[model samples]
Every structure is written in structure tokens, then in C-alpha cells.
Target: MLTRKQHELIRFIQTRLEESGVSPSFEEMKEALDLKSKSGVHRLISALEERGFIRRLPNRARALEVLKQPEDISAGKTAVRAAANSNTALTALKPALAAPREPANDVIELPLHGRIAAGVPIEALEGQATLPVPAALLGPGEHYALEVSGDSMIEAGILDGDFALIRRTNTARDGEIVVALVRGEEATLKYLRHEKGMVWLDPANSAYEPQIYRDSEVEVQGKLAGLLRRYH
Candidate 1:
């Protein structure tokens, strides 16, 4: 059986990957588990790796992939049998055991417009790069991508270093996450809230404070459409 801390760490990694298509950084894991340092997080990650529960990508910083949960091995041949038969009820017992199938269509590529801060607003720079994304993850619109550069939207599962797919638009609904340009000088990703003719850029993490501005001071750049994360 996995220890309590190990279980928590694995679950956190799995949940983050499922939500953002990326594993949490060492700093993120440390903060999430209330550890004192990244060393503690490193040790836990090492332990998990040694136990065959996870594997780190070669030469990549903070790159991790979940191999199998502890319970999956415990289930033994029953789990193997369940995974082989699509119609078996045992297939429902552990969804992760099944392998992922690739899409038949070609992946779509989008322009990567450098990085955007999810914390404090930063000047959005245009970069000459492109990112390949699953066709299903994109919506109908002119779309572009920006690499996230802050933890302000961590609670929303958008972590630093993940690529955010944005649907080009100038309008967004209240409480929807959007890329907002402040006075055409800086750009940020936050929950858009309009109150009494004032615009509020709300961060998902409580450590940061919300930024409030006059409606005329901000312009909606794009709405968050999807997210992409590379293992490396």
C-alpha cells in the first residue's frame, strides 16, 4: 500500500495532468503539499519513481509521467483482463489502465505568441513559433497560443509553462477566464468580472489580489478556449 503522503502526491500529479495536460512543478508540488522546500518534493518524487508509479522524462526539468497507480498492480491479472475486453464491466473498474488511442485526423497547429502572465499583467510579445494541438481541443475562431508564465490561475488548473489556446475575441461573459489587455500596454489571464462599470481581473490563487480598473481601461483580447502541455 502507498503511504498517505505518496498517495496525496500521486493524486495531485494525476489531477493536474488531467486538468492541464501537464505535471506540476516542484515548487508547485511543494506549495500544494505544504512542504518546507523543493527538496522534500524531490524526495517524494524520487520515491514514487523508484516504486514504478511515475517516470521522469530524460533531460527535462520537472517532467514527469504517471505510469500506474499502486492499486492497479494490486488488481493484477483481473485488471489486465478487464483492459483487454471493451465490453467487460471490469473495464470500468480502472479507467486509467486502458491505453489511449490516437485520433485519425491530423493535428492542427496554432501560432505561439510568446508568453502571457497569469499573475501580474505583463506586456504580451509576439513570437515566431507554432504549437500542434489536437483538433478537438480547438473551437471555431481565429486562434492563437501563449505560454503561461505565472501561478495566478493555478486553482483553475492553468499552471506556469502550459500553453493556453485562446479564441480571438473582444468580448467575454462574467466569470469566464479571458485574456485582457490593459490600456493596450499589458496583457493578463484572469476571470473577467464587470461591476458598476469597473473591470476586475481576478486571480484564481488567493495569494494574489484582484486588479480593478475602469471599463474603458481594459480591452478583451481573447477568451480561454483550451490548454496544451508538453512533457518536456
Candidate 2:
């Protein structure tokens, strides 16, 4: 039987692979599992591998294959149901203990910075325009929107003409999509990676090669929060 952390890590890796064909980086796994350090993530991954639940690829970054998933969901649900059925007072109080969700009808206007290239680094246009967004689409944080300008991120379901919602932040973990200012001049939206003191900007589509730069040449401006596609 897999531990809770091992089960969660495998499930997360499987979901990401199904969506983008790229396994999440260790940093992402650490964040997702709420682990305090990458070393914890490493131990969980190693345990999963030893149990024949996952395997790693050679000479590749973030290349993990999920061999099997634990039957935790149904089992956990059954256990919860059994306990809830045994305790009437707890079940009566459960509804009141649940966290309230945000209202669905609220809207917020975000600054619409000009287009950001998905294929190559380009000058991001600064403007005074704003785009009104549904509040449910964004979480708590400062956000902005940028029109996508290339097809390099198409495989990740980010198309040209789509509005890329970005969260304002100067830091990002590996395998996250971010607005990277190149040499403080141009900016592009791509997967951010740090390896061997170099910043690697990776595209979702296989046709484009990954862009490598000195760590100092790339500055993370924001992380991808969500996407808004306008049908023409």
C-alpha cells in the first residue's frame, strides 16, 4: 500500500501528463504536496518508484511515468462514510464546518498589457487598457492579462489570440508558465526552468527548441494564473 504522499504525488504526475504530456518538476511536486523541501519530494518519488508505481526516463528533466494508481479515492470515501454513519452529531455539524465558496457573479477588471509572444521573446506592450474578468476565474492576488501572439504553447492549449491571465510575482518554480522579461527588454510566456545556473524557457509545442539563457538574463515578471479565449 502507498502512503498518502506517495499516492498524491503519483496522481498529480498522471494528471499533468494527461493534460500536457510533460511530467511536473520536483519543485512543482513539492508545492502540490505541501512539502517543506524538495528532499521530501525526492523521498516520496523514490518510494513510489521502489513500489513499482512510477519510473523515470533517462537523460530527461521532469520525465516520470505513472505505472499504477492507488485505490485511495473509493477506499477513503467508504471509510469516511462508515465513520460519518457511526457518528450522527459529527455529520450534523459537517455542513456548518465546510468552508464557504466565493460568490460567482463578481467581476474584476485587470490591466491588459499588450501581446506577449508564445514562440519568441518580444517587447510586451504597456498600456492603460483593462479587461474585465469574472471573479471566479481568479484567486487572491494581483493579476493582469496579455494577448498571446504565437503557437509555441499550442500543445498546452494556449493558442494565439487567447488572453493569458498572469499573477504578478517575481519568483516562479520549475515547470510553471510565466511571463519572463528577457534581458529587461523583451518578454515571452513559456515554461520556466532552472538548471546548472541557466534559465531555460521551454515551449509546449515540440517544433520549437528550448531557449537557454544566463540566469541573470531572465527575470520572472509573473506566473500564469489562467487563460481566457475569445471566440471570433
Which candidate has the top score in TM-score?
2
TM-score of each: 0.57, 0.60
Predictions: Cα RMSD each? 10.5, 13.0
Return the TM-score for candidate 2, rounded to 2 decimals. Answer: 0.60
Error at 96, model 2, angstroms? 23
Error of 2 at 90 (Å): 40
Q: Count clashing residue pairs per candidate.
A: 0, 0
Q: What residue pairs are clashing in model 2?
A: none
Model 2, 179-206: lDDT tens per residue? 9999988999999998898999999999
lDDT by candidate, in order shown: 0.72, 0.72
Q: Candidate 1 lDDT (Cα, whole model)?
A: 0.72
